[model samples]
Target: MLLPRSYINISFFQPPAFLLIGIPGLEAAHGWISIPFSSMYAVALTGNCLILLAITRTPSLHQPMYYFLSMLALTDVSLTLSTLPTTLAVLWFDHQSIGFNTCLVQMFFLHTFSVVESSVLLAMSFDRFLAISNPLRYAAILTNNVIIRIGIVIVTRATVSIFPVPFLLKRLNFCPNKTLLSHSFCFHPDVMRRACDDITINILYGLYVVASTASIDSLLIALSYALILRTVLGLASPRERVRALNTCVSHILAVLVFYIPAIGMSIIHRFGKHLSPIVHVLVAYVYLLVPPVLNPIIYSVKSKPIREAMLKVLRKKGQGS
Candidate 1:
């Protein structure tokens, strides 16, 4: 009987369709392209860390908006920390052969952070919705107790929603080909496709989770923004209108950057396998990881107060030396 090592070697010899895209006969070159992704992640990590530091060190930014922004920064950091190292390791060492346990841990954290991010965005949307829809009650509505409760709910919802995915994936057995996952990490759907068993349950469950959590969050966020727009439009002063709209502008942009590609990839990966794997992988990174880097920069560069706070903190540190 052929050993598992021989089977792995045989599987490695037979590359998937994704490996032949660019450069003829350059299957190994696929790993090289991932370096850019690593660099992007590193930049994102630095930016998020700086934003968190700026927020925590400066007392002037103790308002609710900045507090939410701090939470946003922390979420971004969590997301980057979760995925980037494993991806970079896979790319660098050519170590695509993840053990069953390691893959499960990766999948767990990946989905957990993803769901957390969606929940965070939902919370931010609600924050903006309250601030704009009822300015008089914004303070009363988003008090310390309320914010803490919302934070707990966001964490709990994300944790609970994604717990089943890794558990379900743990029972699957891979056969025929476990070598080529196409993407950097063991994405749930990609891993499911490798299972030797009937995957009808996996597919159905994936669809259910996607529709219920991500799709629902996106819809609610859109509705909130729509109401927010209507409220902002009715304001008498242009300044008030801009101020109200501006509060959500960063979040809206963040939501768009995060959700659009995510929903697109979920559909494409599910229904449109005919598309190029490189395109699919690129889109996945953009959706899954890019926003963590982009969100802080957007808010810092666009919002004068954050930028000023960052600058002030930098200057004080410089002067204290």
Candidate 2:
């Protein structure tokens, strides 16, 4: 019955390796670039964790909006962590090689967290719409159970959409030796494009997945905001309308921080045709990394409770020290 800790704590390390690429023309600057990237990573990690902690410790933040925010914070953490290691490796140490299965696993988490974040933003929009348009019914409409159910559905949707991608990619033949990737981690589109065999199915399926998940999510979010605007306009009191919209400023900023760069990257990948390598790398960084760093700060500045709670935490730490 005696098992050594090492025996139980085994690691399935990289079995096969795929090379990851740093910024192409800026290879000499990888070290320089990594400094800012590492700083952002520190901010993102600390900020998201603090947000989660503030929400968890403060009983007042247990409402539906904060609950959904907790979801967004969790997603941001996962999204950054999924790719940051390989990214830092490539940028800092030129440790660009990654295993095939590990790459697939990374791709799965990256896409999964991407979809989850999108869904959480949509849910946050819905939360604001309900709070503004029908405050009386907001609680009845989105009870704690309902929010929990929504989160489960969002996670389930992301899992189903992204689960098949790696398997599909596995079936393809990568020819002419080691397949090089454009980013520091495995991107499904980037990986699939390198396969030497027929890729029609992958292309079609990729498009289908995008349309079904992201396209629909985008449309629904826009529709929710449109309804929110219409409802706000109808409120007779100027102060009331202003206050209502004020609550939404942080969410709006979060949405823009996430979607705008993501849209730019999609456009570049699908149609921009001759985008520069640095451009793509920068866009990807903006889309994936910025939100995690910005979201907690946005909420702290915009939401009074979060700011007070964070200050209280810091004061406690100072006293304890």
Candidate 3:
């Protein structure tokens, strides 16, 4: 008589629920969403490209506010280009097995652009705060030299801060079963779990990155807005206060769209493992990928000047055609 199969054989026969189902087909849903998302990205890319061109081509937009706006547009473009191709490929092919190197590159670009975006937003907030809070010194304080220095800081800080993540991730030893990433892209935390080595250093570094970039930037943004609000209140005209608030509304909405789900994803991935992997991945992309598509539309539609400028550009192109 044949002997009973070993415990290992028995365990192999009944795998974990995740192992059985694999990463759920949520990425397939991303295909359906990709149509609208692609459209949004296309518009955003075009609009931002135009903004950059207009600012560079036009002498009048050489001021600090427009300079910051140009930087914001560039950041938005970077955000789109970083994730859109990989996302589209995953949706198109139904393939989830990303090569280790490719995954790391994607993660690096994603994090780098994300950090840069946050920094640009913070810079924009400070610019607006200064413009409104101290109108007289605004021109003096935000001179071209000062703006250029700040731009360098934004690029340098973001690049330096996120460089360690990919470097540390390269040292991880991933198990065979861990090869399949659950999402469209390689997210740091999700990939880290697959490591066969101690992740304490990685975890600590991640926490440091979050604290230094996201948390600190958010606090500074809030403080800037607070000062802005106080300054707006002092304005004698209710119309002026409303106009000031309106100018900030786009940035406020953009920040909320970008950060809330990001922080939530970080929280749930760390503490709420009981939740579905599919749900987690969905939340991750919605935060990481969605706002870049949403921002241009929101800003262009809400801000009359931008909307008018876009329309004028389009009209001119149409006439030339």
Quote each prediction's TM-score: 0.87, 0.93, 0.86
Worst 10 residues of 1 by lDDT: 15-24
Each prediction's whole-model lDDT (CA): 0.75, 0.88, 0.76
Question: Predicted candidate 1: what Cα RMSD to the true structure?
Answer: 4.4
Highest lDDT, which number? 2
lDDT per residue as tens, model 1, 1-321: 233576565523322211112222344875786667777888788778878788888787776777788888888888788777667765666554556666667777888888888888888898889888887988887887888888888888878877888777657655644435656665788777766667888889888877878889988998998899898899999999988877788888988888887878888886888977767777777777778878878988888888887777778878999
Off by over 4 Å in 1: 5-35, 316-321
Candidate 1, pairs of clashing residues: none
Candidate 2 least-lDDT 10 residues: 7-16
- List runs of model 2 lying over 4 Å from the truth: 1-15
Tens-digit lDDT track for model 2 on 174-220? 64343678899888888887776788998898888888887888899
Write the residue-wise lDDT of candidate 3 on 79-194 in tens digits. Answer: 78876776666666554455666777778888888888888889989988988888889999999999999999998998898888877877765543445566667778877777
Q: What C-alpha RMSD separates each model from the true structure?
A: 4.4, 7.2, 5.6
